[model samples]
Target: MACISSDSSDLYDVLAGRPRLTGLALAPSDDRLIASVQVINGEGNAFVPGLWEVDPAGEWEARRVTRSLQGEYAPAFAPDGRLMFLSSRENTDPFTRTSSDSTGPGLWSLPEYGEAERIVHHPSGISAFTVAHGAGTVAYTASVLPGAADTAAHAEFREKRESAKITAVLYDSGPTRFGGADLGPAEPHTFVLRPDGTQADVGGQGVVGGGDLALSPDGTLVAYTRAVAGSDPDVNANVVVVADAATGEVRRIFSRPGHHYHRLVFTADGRSLVSQRQRELTYDTPWRVTLVAFDPASGAETDLLPDFDNWPWPGSPVVSPVPGDATVWFTGDERGHCPVFRRGPDGTVTRLTSSGAYSSLCVALDGTTLFALRSTIDSPPDVVRLDAAAPDQQPVTLWAPADPGPLPGTLTEVHTTADDGFPLRAWPVLPRDASAERPAPLVVLPHGGPQMSWSGWTFGFGPWPFAARGYAVLLPDPALSTGYGQRMQERGLGQYGGRPYRDIMMLADATQTRDDIDATRTGLAGHSYGGYIANRAATLTDRFKAIVTYGGQWNLESFQAETDLHAHARRIFGDPLTQRQRYETDSPHLDVRKAMTPMLVVHGGKDYRVPVGQALGLFNDLQRHEVPVKFLYFPDESHSVGAPNHVRILYETVLNFLDHHVLGQEWHRPQLL
Candidate 1:
């Protein structure tokens, strides 16, 4: 393999200024494709995201569509061939109060040969929308103040609150925050909008936030998910419901004691509704997910693929929208990669793509062509076309806006059997020049989610950056990782530190045995659940010279109480009073006195999921024990430090810490830090 020269190779340089294809939509005729690509504007300063039209079968020409400072999203073709999307662009409607200064995104439409116009505007803006394939009905969700029924009422309440400077929000629910934002006095409501501007509320009073909604083919019926409270106040599940779009009549189609249904889509013939059903979490049971198809007329439900073991990715289970055909398509993580699968009308499922991860799936109404964004460990996302009818033909790249150039390192896999005879695996990125005579230092990085596997391509804390610096980085998928089967995830249920920690050590042991790795100079780094494992390893072993833990749980009891999703925490760890022994056995804070390694602790101050207290307590304990420790804190960032400057500083600071501790070099503190 040819390698980029040392002086010219830089991972940041290769990744900078790369435009991403964020969304895709196929025209009604299946001849042209519309994609949302985010790119830097002419000045090369800030991003200006716009829609681009691509020729799927012709010369593969791409033409830019909408150009605005605020990007467009969720592009879809109406039955009448009009292109509709969501944007926060300035509304030209004089009667409406919303303007360019408003933050809410409104619905915009561009006809086949007409200029773009704003069709729908809400006080709180639209979150998501769906279009009927047969009829021109547009269904969307928007957040509104609790006592406000209409858009005018919502706007009135919002204006009064803003004028009064009333920033306090009183919630009657348990969760008060999500995704780094404050959960408001506002609640999500689904509504049906017509082209003529007439709208009706169809989601009913029981509408739940975050549940997906779908519009039926004929525009008469709409399917959506609603929340159902469990016996416990903190526990809640979901059920699917079908409602009349015009009459507001609704009926429950699917519900079970422990199952929640979402990601809904109606079949072309309007007879069946397909959804992803997930079993609620418990102390002993994992979140097992499967697909279920329900016939609305006959009240019959069938499990689509009972034998398929992998959990389907959230963006899938898209049913063909055209009449006379009933084909379903989805993608699932399987054995370190995401593969696309197709299920025909006769109930036979077939695997379509063999490599790379696929997302934003769009199937032609005729059910003969499919479009998706495909990406791998070495490649960025690009639009690709697949022959749904052939199933075995290769995917043709339709549009690729960005390239990472040639990677300075190559990725490979390593595996080992645990002491208990269970199989374990890890991905290693090694520089091209690595050999027996000149081995590379190893950094063992355990994946987060403990249940989420490291597969395909990921931007944050991935392996390639370290490899570009001549260090081999190993990403281990331990006992609880997905894609290997539900049995593997269940193996670590209720006990996070026992089996999963042992799996990481076993995989690291195997990697160090390779001739191209230096066992004497090894370090460990992890984030989230992986951070918990790193903290556990620090107390249990003195093998690694240095270790890094970010957003980790130090005290299990406090973490369970302060986490944003208290229900999820209780499901995995149980009640602190009833199951105190489990917390004591698994918590790293209990064994902090045994730690001997130099450690770097990183955390985001605004992170509500793990909370900043975890890092504060760990740092306090380390300082009292006279352990070599450094705390790198980001006060404004949430769980994910997504700002470009912050991310660059993070990578540089971590590399500097590792170099000083593991490579025995002088500490060179980052200027920003």
Candidate 2:
């Protein structure tokens, strides 16, 4: 293998075609573990995620289970030793033939001694599902049109609208859009399938299945979060609900005015329900998440991690499978790492794993072993097994795809102190042989989410490829980044351009002090909130030689109104109409005249989160100011830009722009661009 910079095509291939393992499921009895492995299909053009059955305790062989063209995910094991998943593949159900245009994912089942078949078909699609541990009960969520009686009626409604060429939709309440998805003519509904082959609608007249659902071990109860519309339109508070799996009877067990609960799971004995309780965002306060255990009988709530400060990463908490066991396991982001944490029955939280981000956590049926996919900042995910009783021990690698080989560089950490005395840390990817005599140019890269942290492995906005191009990429988790304590997150609330920007600069300064990095030639790049930081940095200081912002927010005022999450944006940024001063002071567009560094603006036309107007606004501002700038637009892409070729073009254009600006080379356009 050669240095990635030697051939741009090679860099794209390695990053774009790398195999990924996600969505884990373990069988009830023996050592059968299932994972959704995403790899380049036989066509070698598109990456498809398919289910793989692995024997971790034996020879560690991974056998392909499903090979659908559209792919399969969310693997789970039914109590009857059957493999189930959600897929958008052509439904072959003879009873209800789905039209050719109906490509929504349906619940599929593959028995140990039988063939795979579609078990539950929905008109819109099944998004997520959970199965009972000891009983033959399965619960899934799907979209249903208002006033429709059942799946048949929903399908007919869709067909009539299509036949009439009517594309118009009306929404009386709630959000019209969330991220890349438009708010529905059909709301999400959760359905329960009993052991006797009868179906019941558990979620009625509310967005119940919009989040996550969990089925009890006995298959009698289903726990999930339901949306309760507030007095204001588009504003709703999520409350935890328990439903009768067989009778379709719903009961609202928990509700709070300003807090939301979701990611519900039941204890082994069905005595307690656990959920992630999140406080709603406000203009002055940052949203926070904490795990809570609720007593379903007495309606009492207990804070699981009352003393823990770090935020638990998004995933259902894995409760103990042994009956009467009250132990819970999860992972949280802290100091650039997402490590496993265990909260015992006594409410004591302990750090289980010292490194790697863990997800798809599952405890074996016998309660002796645990299985999860673990990955670090420098490696892809690998399926591993751990002793549930002694989880502090090292995990045994069960199955990992063929290594993508070694990187041209290695990962290292840097530390700094913020202006307010908060400790700041960053991960820097330095090229091989980067020394004082051969220093690599520094690229200050920040993670998005203003509230999200860069704690583990990620396919988006990677730092390794840049290191292959002889750049030291600095990934900083400044104020407002999660995984840190609530205080660290709230430090920069409602002030994107304030402490967060300053903390990024401080971390960048610390990285530049390293002997392996070049202090004089530095660049800045970010996506989403990170992009907002890049734009803010450009206006605040001329320290960086070049800047790149993707799906960035240039004008807070316009963004609060145009974003898909309008209410959310307004909650964080404040209302533009009444809080005019906040917008004027925080928006990067208001201070475009201060920017001197050359910038490359990137955006996706269909990106509803930040919207294309943001990129257009920034490009126009740079042009009006006569600053060196370039725009890369992807009309078909969205907020994350997952298309392989589109990703290639994104990095290709970014590298070209950086080489010309920071490296002081001729501005040669990329071949693909």
In terms of TM-score, the best-performing candidate is 2
Candidate 1 global CA lDDT score = 0.79
lDDT per residue for candidate 2 within 1-673, as digits (tens), equals 4434535457658756767887788887756788898877665546788988888684757888888789998888887678898888886667667463368888889987667888887777878888887797988887888888987788899888889998777867656666776767888888898888888787753633364788888998888777664344224466678878887676446876667787888898988888988877678767777888888778888877767877634346889887898888887787887777777778877777778888888887776677888988988888888776564567888888656667768898889889989888888888887998999998988889877777778888888767777888999998888877888867877667899888988888888888878899999999988899999988999998999999999998889888876777777767777877678878999999998899999999889999999999999999999999999998988898777777777888898899899999999897866
Top candidate, metric lDDT: 2
Model 2: ten consecutive residues of lowest lDDT: 228-237
What C-alpha lDDT, on a 0 to 100 scale, does residue 57 get in candidate 1? 73
Worst 10 residues of 1 by lDDT: 1-10
Using all chains and alpha carbons, the TM-scores for the candidates as numbered come to 0.94, 0.95
Q: Give the TM-score of candidate 1.
A: 0.94
lDDT of 1 by residue, 589-613 (tens): 9998999899999999999989999
List candidate 2 segments past 4 Å from native: 1-8, 41-46, 93-101, 205-209, 233-236, 312-315, 389-392
- How well does candidate 1 score on lDDT at residue 117? 88
lDDT of model 1 at position 241: 76
